[model samples]
Each structure stands twice: as structure tokens, then as C-alpha cells.
Target: MHIELKYGNRKLQGEIPFDAQLLQPCIPPPAENPALQVHRALDRPLAVAPFEQIFSAGERVVIVTSDITRYTGSEIYLPILVERLNACGIADTDISILIALGIHRPQTEAEHRKILGPLFGRIKVFDHACDDPAQLVELGETSAGIPVAVNRRVVETDRVIVTGTVGFHYFAGFGGGRKGLVPGVAARKTCMASHFSVFNKAPQTGKHPQATAGVLDDNPVHHNLLEAARMVRCDLLINTVLSPQKEILGVYAGELEAAHLAACEQVQDLYQPRTERVDLAIISSGGEPKDINLIQAQKALDYGCRAVREGGTIVLLAACRDGFGHEHFYPWFDYQDLAQFEAALRENYQINGQTAHSLLSKARRFRVIMVSEFDAEITARMGMEKARDLQQAIDMAHANLSSMPKTLVIPDGGLVLPHQFVKVKTFADPA
Candidate 1:
């Protein structure tokens, strides 16, 4: 069977066995006009007053946006939102755009211009520097002990508007909503505190019971993020749900928690696909920037882990063009002994260190075959087998299975979550 997988800015074609189950996000047809939909959503905000009524003239406004790593399509929506804010009598000088970079690398001027489009020339734009103590303003702590230090610009402004795309975050339930507050504009210590909530004292176990994807009710990381957002009083939130190709399927606007939660419930069905367990899984990390680095691409591996049975094999396809996304993550791979690494992680756990633990935890249950740009040495050091090509990766995975195993192929594993199944027994009486 011939199939096409998303690669960076292109498609990768390969042949797999016809029997391999092809899993994909159940994204509906794209909206007739996504840009128009966004404008309409802003006009009729959900559960809150519209922009004009919400703010008055002479008020300083701070627009918080996701940075480059997050594919929010700010260029598409920022201009429209800015125009609306202007119509509300907010002057150009009174408005500022803050990129919620969190602890990620700061974006270049060229990249920022590209993300903001024409607005780059007219409005003042700045990237949040989480490490810079001067740029952060202390906003007291949540009851859970998270010291909430947000960007000074956001706290000083009269109104704050958060804009970002919505999707399943590997840990924090779903992305969007209060995320723009906790990690988006938060100080380094605040971000670390929320992230640490995902860590388990016993790192060897690999899973944080409350940090699993698609869960929120009992999720400590998510709940704390919400508390931080509320503590700062986010005025309005504009979040979008997109297709695998990053088309806007739905636009949500209004009160921080209400609008985001509504969008999550509305859009999750599009990404969750019900399936039984499989022995061998072939997965892609939704291509391009999603797979731009091995660290970010680990999200797809987690999704694949959900579909594959115990002692199964997962063949992952990612570009990883940028290598490991975070500098701190590479060293964890040097610890050859899993027990020793777990011991070290427990002693001194850093933020990105969790990614290494997650990788090792998944490796213990399933064989991980990685096909990427990383050299064999690096791949081996990461505790994964390197594959020369897609077919070679598949061949290696098949070798580990007994007989022709039940195979599953996820075109965009990052977005397509597998649903758990319940067993039912049948009884019959014979004559």
C-alpha cells in the first residue's frame, strides 16, 4: 500500500503492508473561511462582554501571544484582533504585544516579524524573558505554593488579552486557556514550579498519574496553571482549535477558563480515535516543526505508546532537524543504566529532565525505533535504534514481533489519541 506522511514542508511517500491500520485525526472539513470565523468569534465573545464594552479608551493593553515554537498562526489573527482593539479607541501606542516565550529560546527579529506579519511595523512587540528578573512582577503565590511572577508589562497593563491555538498538551491536559499565563508570561521560577508538579518522587515508574494526556479533573499541573491565571485576572482569551494541517476548525473567545474548557470538549472528539491494542505501531509526529526536534517529537511517541500493547514495537518518523530542542536534555541520555538515571533524576530533577525519564519509561515497555536526521551514535545514546529509512525502520520493527503482528499506522500521532476499550463477555446456553 502506498501512503504519504507529513515531513517538514513536504510529504514523504512509502509503501507499507495493506493490513496495517491507518489511524488519523477525525478532523472535519475545513471552515469555508477561517479568517472570517475568527473575526466573528471576536465580535461575539463567549460568556463575556465584547471587546468594545470590556475596555475603555486610554487603557494600556497587553496582547499575549505564543512564541514561534507554538504554531498559533498569529499573523492570521493578530492583525484582525488589533484592528478590533483599535476600533475600541485603544491607540497604537497604548497597546503592546508580548510573546509568551516561557523558558524556550527567544525568537529572532525576522521570526517575530513573520509571526506578527504587518503588525510588526506598527505595534511595539517584545518577547518575554523568563530568566530576566527585572522583567517579571511578583503576583503572590497560589494556595498550592506556585509563586506567580508574570511579565511586568502584563501586570502593569490595564487590560490583558491572550491569543493562542488549542491542542492536546502531553502533560497539562490541553494547551491554550490559562497556559498563556502560567508558562506563557510567567517568570522562570513560576514556570518551573508548575512543571515540577508533573514529577513523581519515584522517577522509575515513568508515568505521573495526574499528568497523563486528555485528563484534567485530577491533573495537578493543569489545576495549578488555572489558579495562576485567575490570580492575575486575565480579561479575555482567544483560542483556536485546528486540524492536523493547522487549519482553524473552531474559534473560542471569552472568559479564560470557560471558553478554553468549552473548546477542549468541542474539539477533542476530532482527535481521539477508538482502537484496540496493537503489537506494532508506525507513527509520525505530525511532521515539520512538531517534529522539528527529537525532544518536541517525543509527544508522538507517548501517543503511540497508548495504542501499542505491552512489549510492542513503535517505529517513529520525525525530522528532528534542530536536534534535541533543549540543551539540558542531551546529557540525560549519557546515563546508560536506567536505575542510575532514575536515582539521579530523583536527586536533582530539572525541567526538560522529565523528557528523558519519559523516553526511558516508554522504552522499558516497548521497543522504540527512531527514523530521523540524528546520527546513529546519537540515536543509540538516546536508547533508540536508528533507521536508515522508513522501510528499514518497519523491517526492524517487524523483526521484533512474533509473526505478522497486528499493526497500526498513525499519520499524526501527536493529535490522534487512541481511546481505551472495555471488554464484554457473552454467554450461551446449549440445548
Candidate 2:
């Protein structure tokens, strides 16, 4: 069968076996009027009062949102939120939008305009500087001893509203909710401390089993982040569930944890699809922003790998026009040995190092053939075989397999997570 998958801004065409299983998200049609959907969510929020009832005329407001890397339909929802604040007798001067850059690079003027939509000039927008000590305020510490420090603007604000899209996060359970506050606007040290929880304590140096995709309970990383977020006073939370097409499918609003949890459930229903394990999987990291960089594109690999059998082949299509997401990201690949890498990470951990570790670990386990802008030599350094195009990648996969293997193809691999259904046999007991 002929198939076309997204690669950066373009699409790559290739042919696969006729019987190959196609894995995709069960995305419902986008909301007819996305703004109206946001309004409805605010009116009927979960476990908290409506937005109008919570904020007063005199209160200063700050809305924390995801940075440019992770699109959250911010352009569609931010206008409505600002309008709602205006309706509550709060002037635009009293409300500011804080770009939750975390440890990411600052956004350009064009990026800022895109994030704020129509509210770009009307309301002030500030970028969170995680490394700037003057911009952060110490907020004590979580019970787990993770130091909590966040943007001073958020801490000083009279009412704080956290907003982002919810999806299957690789390690920290799900994105959105407390993530908008903790790593979003948190200090660099705070971000590192919370994320370090992904690893188990000393003596047991590997990653914690529970700190993985689609899990929240007993996820030490999630718990630490939530605890750090709790140190701050967030008045409301507004999270959206986006379709693979980047349309807002559902909007969740109200209390911080409750509203975000509701969004997470919506994600599970839409993104998680059950399938039988396959010997080969062809996956794409969606397109454009999703494949803008290698660091961001790793999510697609993480989710799609679940559908493949042990020691199977994965043809990952990621354009990565922006190169490695961070300058520090590529250096982590220098530690070729998994044990040595883990030891180094344990000694001095960086989030990018963790991602590199995850990527290398997968590369070692699976025969990952990546179709990207990265050169063959660069890809080889990270333990992956680089192909010039999708057709070449498909051909490579076939060459690696001993026989005509069962295959699975994921078009929007970044958004969709495929879970293998293990059939447990039940024996007939004494009748």
C-alpha cells in the first residue's frame, strides 16, 4: 500500500506491505466553534467556581502558558481567556501573559505574536527566564525536598491561571496541569531537582519503572512536580486536548489538578489505541513544529516503539530542521555506553541528557532507521541508522528483517500511543 507521512513541513511517500497495520489516534472532529468551547469550559468548570466568580476587578492576573515548542491552540484560546478577564471588570493593564519557556530559549517577536494572538499588544507578555535569579522567587520546598522556585511575576500575581495542552508525556506522566507551573516557569535548579526524581535513589541507579508514558500514580517525577506546583497558589487551570490536526477537540477548566486530570482522561480516550505487536513499525513525528528538532521528535519514537516486538525495526521519519533541540543535547550522545551514561547522568543530570539516555537506550534495543535531515555519521553517533528518505528507510527495514515481517505504520506518531494487547489465558478450574 502507498502511504505518505509528514516530515517537517513536507510529506514523505513510500510503499509498505498490503497487510501492514496502520496505527492512528481516534480523533473526534474538531469543535465547531473552538472559542465557544473554551467559554463553555470556563462556565462549567470541574471542581471549582467559574472564572468570573474567582477573579475580582482589583486583582492582578497572570496566565501561564506553554512555550513555542509545544503548541496548545494558544492562539484560539488566549483571546477568549483575555476577553473573559475583561468581562470580569479587570482591565487589560492588570493582566499579563507569561510564556512558560522553562529552560527553553526565548521566543522571537514573531513567536510571541503567534502565542498571544489578538491579545499581543493589548496585554503585556513576558518570557520566563529560568536562569535569571532576579526574576525568580523562592517558594520553600516540596515534602520530597525538591526546591521550589518560580517566576516572580507569577508569585506576585493576585490570581494565577495555568494553561496548556494535555498529552502523553514520556516520563512526567502527562503534560499540562502542574507542568505549566513547575518546569514551565520554574528556576533551572528547581527544574533539574524535580526531573531527577525520574531516576531511583542511590544503589538502584536506573530509571524508576513507574516514571513513564501514560502513568501518573506512583510516578515519582509526576509526584515531585505536583508537589512543587502545589507550593505556588494557582487560582484556576485551563487545559485543552488537541486532535492530531492541531485542532482543539476538548477544553478542560477549573481547579488545577482536577481540570488537568479530566483533560488527561480525554487524552487517554483519544490517543491510546490497542494493537498486536509487530516486527516492524514505520512512524512519523507528525510535522513542522513536532519535527522541528531531534529532542522534540524523540516523543514519536518513544510512543511508537511500544507497538514493535523485541529487537524489531523502527523507521522513524523526523525532519529535525532545527537540529538538536538544545546545544547541550548533542554532547550527551558522547557517552556511548549505557551504564557509563547512567552513571554520568546520576552524577550531574540535565533534562536533555535524560532524553539522550532514553533515545540511546531505545536505539540499542531496536534497529532504529531514522529518515531525517541529520547526516548518517551524526545519526550513527546516537546509535541510529540514517536514511535519506522514506523509501530508502522502508527498503532498509526490509533488508534487516529475516522474513516478510508483520508491520505497523503510525502517521501521527507524536500524538498517538499504541499499546499491545496481551491476551491472558484463563484456565478452566474445578467446575
Candidate 3:
């Protein structure tokens, strides 16, 4: 019996005993319908807390949410959250929406309209400006020593409602809880500190992050986020977990850490991918996000790294309109090859960013192919191959595959990663 294995453009067909197997049937771990418990998750919030306790009749409350873009695919969750807020008697007019722009570019009017819809026209809607570098209001520092500066509107508002997704994160353990505040509404320097801050200490990463495995309460990063939210007087934390097809899995609201972690249990079950051997992996951003930023783009490296071979290829399919997130990250990934480039940046910390440096420290080794309108020629110079089209790249890889290469394919790159679905293995066979 012979088994075919793929490593990027090459494939290896190895002869095995009849008892040995190659092709494996993969059934993504099925997640229980948390939606049935959705009402349960919120039962305490709605049933216990009175409307005026969280908000008042005439007070202003801003609902901070990520605008509909390629990342997070937050359109569905945004409205569901607002409807919940409206039911609390927080009139739509008193509600203002501030997209946690973070380091990503500003959201356009068309995107804003589509994100909000026609239901609540009276609410004021705006996006956080991280590029301004001017209006930043630094509140204080976190226990981790990361400085926190949130948008003035966010702090000035009588109350704040954070809306985001909960999933596995490379740094800061996980996403959703305090994330919307730091990079979402925090200033440029603050966003830089919050995001790049992960580089200060090496992250614990392997096939799985033990620290990131469970929900937010136990995660220190989540705790740090809670502190940041407390500084700005965050009243409510609303997070959602969506299925592969973008269906609502569950919603966890109220207390930050506990709620975020509860959501992660569900998100990890769905968004996590499952594949053991992958020489070449194809991850698409699902073409849902309007534009892919380096911050959101980092998911590919986090969850997808587990499936790749020791020396393999990782093709990230995203539209990174903003290019390398921070000026500091360019020199990190910008090299003749990741090896030489990473060495230079690590040896000379003068050029690398905080969190970007953190990522380089963990990666085993893999090449990234930027396959969107991200100034392809420029990235090509830095060793990252730029593909004109997704199919074209795949065709080229197929053209170069070995006689039998074990290949793994992940359709929606944004939501899935190699590590999420499969356990990583040591690659010693070069055949």
C-alpha cells in the first residue's frame, strides 16, 4: 500500500503495510447547540439587573463594536446585541456605535450603513481613530505595565457595551473581553503597547496553549483586559460565538472574564480546525472582511501553525489594505527569508515591535504568502511570495507537488487554523 503526502509544491508517496494508513477521515469536532443556553447565559443579566442599574432613561451609552469587515465577520452579532440593548429600554437614539478600529484603517460610510442597518437611525455611529496620534487620552497603566489610553467618547459615555467574538488568540491568551477596549478604542501608542506588548515575555505555545485553553477568568491577559475596561467604566461586555457557516452558537454577557471564557469554550469547539499532517496549507479570510489588517491577519499564524510541516508553506489569503500593521513589524517579516530577517530583528530589537517580536519567538518555521492587494511586489522583495490569484497559486503548487504530498486544505482561513483542528507532530521523514 502507498500513501501520498504533500509538502508545499512537492508530494511524497510512501509505501506502507496494508495495516498502515495515509488518508484519514476528518470530522470537525461538533459543538453542542449553546444557543439553547443563550437565554441561560443572559438570564442573570436581564432577570437580575434592572434597566436603570446599567443605563438610565436619558443617559448616553455607546455600543462599541467592530464594523463589518473581513475580520471577525461581526455583522450578525452587532444587530443581535443592539436589539438586546434596546429591549433594556436604552432607546436607540441614546446609543452610539464606535467601531474598535484599532490600528486598522477607518470604516467607510457604506460599511457603517451596512453594519448598523435602518432599524436604529437615531443612534450616533462612529469608528475609533488609532492613526490620529493626537486625541489619545491615556488613562493609566495596567498591572502588566502596558499603558491604557481609550477614546474620549468611550470614557465620556455614561456606559459602554463591547461587542466582539471569542476565540483562541496567539497572545493575551484569547480574544473578546478587554480586547475591544485596548486595540479597539485605545489610541495608537496604546494600541501599539497593548498589541505589541506580548513580545516583552515569550508566550507559551506548542500544539496547544495551556494558558489559553480554558476561558478568560483564569487567563492573566483577560484579567489585564478587565482592569483596562474597569478604568474606562465599561458597564457591559457582550461577546458572541459563531459557527462555521456564520450561525450564532451562543452569547455570553455581563462579567468580563467569566463571560469571555465561557464563550471561548464554544468558539474553540467550532472555529478550531482538525488536521494532523499538512505540508502546504491554504487559509482564506473567507473574503468576508472588507480589508485584512495585520492584527486580525495574525490569526493565521496562531491557529494555522500546528498543521504545517517543520519546513513548510503557509499561504494566508487576506486583503491587508493597511500592510504590515506597525512600522516595527515590517523589518520582522521583511527579510530575504524568515530566518535571516527574524535573526536580524531579534538580534537588533531596535527595529521590531513588541507583539510582533513575541510571535517570531514561538514560530517553529514556515513561509507566508500574502495573496491580497497588499502591495504584492513589495512583500515579494521581503521573501513572502505574492499570488495574483488564489487559484493561480494553488495551480502552481499543484504543478510542483511531489509524487505524493499530504496536503491539507482549510476553506475559510479567517475562522480556522491548523492547530485549532489538528494536533501537531514532529516531522522527521524527508521522503
Q: What is the C-alpha RMSD of each candidate to the true structure, in Å?
A: 4.8, 4.7, 7.2
Best-fitting candidate, measured by TM-score? 2
Q: Which wins on lDDT, candidate 1 or candidate 2?
A: 2
Ranking by lDDT: 2, 1, 3
Model 2 lDDT per residue over 1-431, tens place: 78899999889999774347777766768757798899899899999877789988878999999888898999988888888888988889999999999888899999999888888888899999999999999988888888889999988889999999999999998999999998999999999999998898874378999999899999999999988998888999999998888888999998889998999999988888878888888999999778889988999999999988889999999999889988889999889999999999898999999999999999999999999999999999999998999999998899878666878888898888787774211111121
Worst 10 residues of 3 by lDDT: 16-25
Model 1: what TM-score? 0.93
Q: Write the per-residue lDDT of candidate 1 for residues 1-431, one digit (tens) a residue.
A: 56677755666776664357767655677666778978888888988988789988888999999887678878888988888888889899999999988778888898899789989989999999988989988989999888999889988889999988887888898889999888998988888787777866555664468787888988988998899888776789999888887888888889998889978986677888777788888888888768878777888998778888998889888988777887888888777777777677667766678778778778777888988888888887877889977888877877767666777888888777787653211111111
Model 3 residue 2 CA deviation (Å) reads 21
* Least accurate 10 contiguous residues by lDDT in model 2: 422-431
TM-score per prediction, in order, is: 0.93, 0.96, 0.73
**Order by TM-score, highest first:** 2, 1, 3
lDDT of candidate model 2 versus the reference:
0.89
- By lDDT, the better pick of 1 and 3 is 1
lDDT score, candidate 3, position 89: 75
Q: Cα deviation of 329 in candidate 3 (Å)?
A: 5.7
- Candidate 2 Cα deviation (angstroms), residue 83: 0.8
> Which one is best on lDDT?
2
Candidate 1 RMSD computed on C-alpha atoms after optimal superposition onto the true structure: 4.8
Off by over 4 Å in 2: 422-431
Query: For residues 84-123, what per-residue lDDT tens digits would candidate 3 score against the true structure?
Result: 6677676778778888877666777777877666533656
